[model samples]
Target chain A: MNFPTKVYINEVVLRDGLQLEKKLINVEEKEHLFKRLKSAGVQSFEFGSFVHPVRVPQMANSGELYSKIQQAAGDADLIALVPNLKGAERAAQLSVKNINYVFSVSETHNLQNVQKTTLESLEELHEISDLCIENKISLDVSLATSFGCPFEGEIPTDRIVSIVHQVTELNINTLTLADTTGMANPKRVFQLISLVRSEFPKQKLGLHFHNTRDMGLSNILAGMNAGVSHFDTALGGLGGCPFAPGATGNVCTEDVVHMLHSMDIQTNVDLKELLKASHLLEEIVGHQTPSYLLKAGPYDKKYPVPVST
Target chain B: MNFPTKVYINEVVLRDGLQLEKKLINVEEKEHLFKRLKSAGVQSFEFGSFVHPVRVPQMANSGELYSKIQQAAGDADLIALVPNLKGAERAAQLSVKNINYVFSVSETHNLQNVQKTTLESLEELHEISDLCIENKISLDVSLATSFGCPFEGEIPTDRIVSIVHQVTELNINTLTLADTTGMANPKRVFQLISLVRSEFPKQKLGLHFHNTRDMGLSNILAGMNAGVSHFDTALGGLGGCPFAPGATGNVCTEDVVHMLHSMDIQTNVDLKELLKASHLLEEIVGHQTPSYLLKAGPYDKKYPVPVST
Candidate 1:
């Protein structure tokens, strides 16, 4: 499974995984966990979000979390998700390494989840893009609900392309398509991702998928074939969409790392230690997470062959 | 996400999936389920394994099931999975359309599970290939545990090549690599599949995967990048290996089809009907199943967007 180049495994555990849980992980535990995950080979971490404190209390300490990550590892790249211009402003004030500003392209979803129309969100995107450029922070524009939407099923490809066109025009080359609901099918994933790729040929495309429909990894595969190299995953498949209430967790981090490493796509993540993180997260979330690798351990460690020493 | 090409979905509910359970599905229920699954847009079905009935009583009525499938449809392409010479002999004798012969290239797994060395399995595979050819039956060689083996942690690409080299010398041309333990990572899948494509060139390549390590769909994506078209799956992710007690179920057919269809990869499957088949399989098995789409419903069908009376 040796593929010459390495694919980045950006840990979204601190943000995506923690956002939905009721219990807040304080700054110290966040730092300790992030440091441990880094030791297991995660290069970049989407540590938290600067979304409104009223909506996401769990991320109330993200401002503090960002500062600590810088203290812990000077070279570590940190990303904080921002939903609007104000959120982006909060992220920028912290002087973070990376700011990921998300907006939905699907009108129905955009109106419902973010309380803004698609066009309005696009306006916000322009403002955020300019602010990030002026501040010299790496900005990743995430098109949320890029696949199918639970609110609006079967999002059109043209809609996605035009959004990419809008964002790409701002000279923002890095982008992500979030499968907010487990709504993406491989064909839709391939078609939409390809459209994004063809339009932004030089852009780095990343995927943030949910396993709601159990095709998270497959969707990633579809995106990868369409020339995507980056992906977003949460540890232990944590994070329920507060909007969708019952939707499952984000695609599991250790699970993603395990698959990538096995495929010989160098994730540099030690599966044994990632499993250790799953163990740690289980305690924080106060229940077992949905990740199977967390429960079963790595493929090689299973049943331990009966060889005598 | 639209790619305008028909993707084949082969149902393996009876073979790989049923082989894992404690209770055997009655012959009537299995036939009834297959009949409905056929109508649900599954064009191909790996009817059952032709192994010893004693080893898998769950498959004690495979001969009956095959005859029923033939009687049920005039042109349904029913393929049967055959593990060795005897399984092949029984499958060849049956009035089925195709015979699938499997050989794991991993020496440790081949030894642990089948008590045969890799060389010996290849010898048996050669004989099975000849038997299918002489009988004028179409054949598919499944390289089981291809991604990684349970007993042997990582399967090398060279070993896969050696097996392919030996099998290609025989009368068989169609091939599949099975992630039998869900141990395969996308990178490994891409590299091995790419290697096989470069080497085999003209032969058809298929993938049969499990979500054990939660990377099955991603592996399929990797396969697509390397030009694989065919896939093997069980309805409802229902199988597990009884011989190896803790193994997981096969990749769910409806889930795979839904993903493809959503991606605009044309799978003939009707999501609602397939979910019905999954529900029916649950009734026959006298228990619930692990399929997400079956319980959660399709992304399009869910939240049904109301109706004007």
Candidate 2:
């Protein structure tokens, strides 16, 4: 029953959340969402990713969106997702304060996502790490498919540990283990996180989970039990992996915040304000997002007593 | 991280799942679903409730449906929910082998649901217990709103503990603590289940949770951690409380089984067969269900890797 009193939430609606979205949101719309989330006490965000425009047209305007919202971030950590050294250079050119260098631990996924092998991606991470150092920008590394690979079933824990070992060697601010295809169960999350925690006790760790299997919240609980506090969540549970089509995206932000707040674990996020942003997200997406809080409201909401016959 | 190696799922879709639906499936259709679930290794079921036919018309054919499917059950526990002594009497006349008597821990909710006080409902449980003994039928008790109430925000732990104390005195086979409004978080679930387990060391206990707040699976996990192995789940996550409209109902049977299986906890239920039944349920209900497995498939399902450019 023991848990951390405070948990940090890294909002990723604008980046990972919108990357697979069909409607390409303009920079102004992305800024509006950013301001709304910032006001709702989201102190960290992944606003957009610096990927090739033609490949991921949805994130093509990362630079424009960053420029428009950078001043309003105000002490908050605004991170951009960078696939490699070129994306890192693009983010640095825009003076982005923080960037998350993500690569898959699964070689097949890595090749499919960025046309690079795991070793090649690690080499690119080195280059991206050096670029961040030169630009005085904070860098975080996310190992996608850390839990399991779609093409290759169960990933060996040693592989993730080795990747973490290599990734932590650089001057990275945080290391995130991403369940890229939502294949992680709670037990696996607990076992992997416990191993990683013991292996790299001093490393600042975060977890990114997808709700495709409806194990998202449970996996997050397991992550918390294993001593990780930071989680990446999307507003209204938007975005799906291009590889895992028809599956859900990240663990939802408002749902996670509501659960944490209910358990007295402070996330410093306002549920009402977050719901407002979630509703706005639904409107922007032109479809309903798979957010439980948006559909059922909060747990404390009381219904009117029915008049007895 | 410790959990039970074996978990028992009590499928309640026939009773709780279809109760809230506008469509009243015929007895034959219900029998088809019942047989399908039975073939999928589901040995326990809450087939239907015995309420005023006009009041809950959805379960009006409980007796006929029970008769149609009872012979095929073949040692499987086919249980019916009874609201009071009259419902118990009706079930006994049908020669029902097992009956579950349910009353809310929250007096206001009890009054609204059954036009009786909590104390009055306990009085009826005594009568139902006597009838069950006379009919040679096993009896179980479910305390609805044991977690939290929609009318009353939080039901005191002492109130629930006292209710459990009074109910366990009868010859009840098992006692279930129900989150009628889906208000139980994992921490609260762990704390309450721990208290109940300590107080009634020999009592066989169960948990009934709703996915309304999306904490159903996590609460079940916490309950398992506290030594309760039996759980009530519905196929396709059907059924909503009449009192709490717009809120989702019981946790999906497939989702819970999927998670438990992923953790290597044996449920003896075939997930693929259960999914086939879930798809049939979707067709029966004439709409898509809120089942994660139906939407996302299982974690081991692999997609064809895109041919790299």
Candidate 3:
């Protein structure tokens, strides 16, 4: 039942979130969001992906967005998603400090998502790792579909551990085990996180989750109890699985921060300012985002007295 | 990390769910809902409340609805909510097997909600307990706002323990600690349930949670890990506090069941049949309810492969 007092939340709204959104936010709007998130005390931002514009047109302005936001980001860490060596090279050219490379453990998902087999993706990751090292950038590899696969059923722990072994061998000490389709439960989350923690005692791990099945926050709690402190969250709970239709967005950053602060856990992100950012995102998205804090205020907010009998 | 192999979910849609809804469902409609829920393998149901019709017009026809559905209930345990001696007497007339009485541990919430101070409610509960014992009806007392109060802030653990002590002294060992405003986090849920379990070793404890803050399922997971086997859930995630504005509904029965089955935990409930019931409830409610399963199909349901480059 142990939980970390302080947690590091990396905002992924620009990359993992808006990547699958219907509306395409321009570079100017992206600059606005980056600023808002920074003002909300987000020290880490995954601003964009270096994937092909034709594949994910929403992130086509990654190069321009990086140039515009990096100066404004100041001391905050700005990371970019890189699928392979080419993406890594593009990100390094922007002088990004952190480059994230993701590959699914599920073979079928790896093929369907990045058009590469699991081993082939690993090979590309090795090359991407070298590229990041040469550019003096830290490479963070995320094992997508590490919990369960949409095409395949439950993934074995051995498969996940083996992949982690390979990734760590490439000197990528920071890893994210993603619930790509939100098929993870509390038990599985605790089990997987504990397993990874024991195997790689010194490795820094983050849990990336989706609220597709409404177990996002529950899984996060499990991860926290298992002593994993880094969580990947989205503002206003934006983002959907390009593979799993009807799957909701990532876990809401404001909601998660509000919950953490309520339990006396320090997240460093200001809840009120985060809500303001969520409100702006809601307006920009032109629809209601799945933020519990935005809809229902903090637990301490008072309601009118009940009409008694 | 231990989860019960078998969990008991007491469906409260008819009683808690429909009570705060805007539309008034007819007796015949209630009969349909009860049958649908029974077919979903719900072993227990809180179908009606014996409160004064003037106060809660939604449950005015509890007597008629009980009479109509009691015969058809068969093996399922049928329960009704009773606010006072008169409500308990009315419920006894219908030969109800289980009668639940709820009073908030928070003095302010109890007074604001039921128009009675905590001591006054306990006094009434003693009389109601005597009536239930004489009528051979099982008495289950739920301590509402056991975690936090809408009017007041967090309730002290000692206050909840004192209330539980009062209820158990009446020989009503079945107790429900309800999160009236969905303010209970995982840590608080584990701590409170653990405290209560240690104090009342032989008592049967149930958790009633709301999705207001999106921690409903997380709280349930925490309760389960703390060795609680009984939970109160609503169909279509219906049910909100009549006292607390902007408070969302209870945890969706289908979503909870779906998550349990995903983790290989058995609840003996048919997931498909439950979704069917949820769909029917949605049609009856004439709007989209807060059910995740109804919107996003179960975890095992797969999506078409993404057309990747």
On DockQ, the candidate that comes out on top is 2
Ranking by TM-score: 2, 3, 1
The better-scoring model by TM-score among 1 and 3 is: 3
* lDDT-superior candidate, 1 or 2: 2
Model 2, total clashes: 0
Report clash pairs, candidate 2: none
Candidate whose lDDT is highest: 2
Query: Could you give candidate 1's per-residue lDDT for residues B73-188 as a string of tens digits?
Result: 65767888877888888877775669887767777777656668888988887777678778888888888778777776777788788888878877675688888777777767
Checking candidate 3 for backbone clashes, the offending pairs are none
**lDDT (10s digit) by residue, model 2, range A181-209:** 78999999998999999999889999999
> What TM-score against the true fold does each predicted structure earn?
0.85, 0.99, 0.97
Residue B177, model 1: lDDT of 85
Report the C-alpha lDDT of model 1 over A199-264, residue by residue, as the tens digit: 778877888888888888777766666777788888898875666534677888887777666555
Question: What's the distance in Å from true for residue B167, model 2?
Answer: 0.5
TM-score of chain A of 3: 0.97
For model 1, fnat equals 0.64
Q: Pick the candidate with the highest TM-score.
A: 2
Where is model 3 chain B poorest over a 10-residue stretch in terms of lDDT?
A: B300-309
Over 4 Å off, model 3: A244-246, A306-309, B306-309
